[model samples]
Target: MPTQPSLTLAQDLCARLCHDLVGPLGTMAGALDLLDDDAEAAALAREAAASLRARLQVWRAACGAGTGPMTAPEMAALLEGVLGGGRVTADVTALPPGETFAPDVAQLLLVAALLGGEALPRGGVVRLAPAEGGVAVLPAGRVLAWPAALADALAGQEVEGPRQVLAPVLVRLAQAAGWAVSLSAEALTLRPM
Candidate 1:
């Protein structure tokens, strides 16, 4: 069986989720507030709600029990959800329809995208490509902030100290997928054994 994160790490994940959700949640609330006065606001509220729903679906696919053999369109929607109306963009245009990945693999790619977003504080483009055995993530932007410790963990190295809050979970997911994670200044790749 794949390794599961410890309780403390699980709590950290929850905190991260809450952090990411705050903006969209606030958007939904603000949209509703506007609805009381303007008809156009209702449409905006609906859009925000839909965005939230899409993001929730992606979160479920990543962390929930029902990891899907999700279709290309489905995966595209999930990636877009991660964009979250930010300056960052995902180029999933190359993904062919009907192609799917194991849930673990999909989750790792998503998390990698999240990592890329974090690396580019000012926002950038995330490019996706289906490679043999797994996927490739290319982020073009400012300097990447990936810590050396996390890189070692992802490369399947044993580290001594307490793991970074998000490290254990991501490493577990990548390992569960039978993937060897490699990160460079230009891109991150997950290669299956």
Candidate 2:
């Protein structure tokens, strides 16, 4: 990749993260503002702080410095924070006992779950299962429409557009780790190359 393209990719990824974070952050800001009139200011402030902390935990794991190990269940909890309720159910039965993922793979898995959940805006179950040589995300429910260009981007092909932004980052990370990325209506699989 050229220097300019890499820079552009980084910028776009930043934008996507900001877009996702803005909601919780904005809510927290509003809660703080409510302190001026609300009688339950302390409770409201505590609730807002908890929400902020949950979001920060997810974002931290998603964009962490890749220095620590993370488990599948931990990732699921962070993902639950992102989904904000019982909207997405996580299943990690296939993860080996005591197995942990490197920071990058853990982040990629969490992001994959997020994408899978987004594919089912009406709510669904996201399963993390053992694949042939790696892991797979199986989302079952109302499968939303996914653009072909975005699929191409997730498969490591260069593409441009707002929807394609984060998929490419996942693809690049998979590539660097010698993993194959696959996308389909039912599931997304990442496996050894």
Worst 10 residues of 2 by lDDT: 77-86
Q: RMSD of model 2, in Å? A: 2.9
Clashes by residue pair, model 1? none
RMSD of each: 4.5, 2.9
lDDT (Cα, tens digit) per residue for candidate 1, span 1-193:
7443465567666776676677778988998988879889888888878877866776677666646566556666677746524667777666676677666777777766666655665677777777665677777766556546567767666433232444556687877888887777777777887
Best by lDDT: 2
What's the lDDT for residue 93 in model 1? 64
List where candidate 1 sits over 4 angstroms from the true fold. Answer: 1-5, 71-73, 94-98, 130-133, 142-144, 147-149, 155-166
TM-score of each: 0.77, 0.83
lDDT score, candidate 2, position 37: 87
Model 1 reaches what TM-score against the true structure?
0.77
lDDT of all predictions, in order shown?
0.68, 0.70
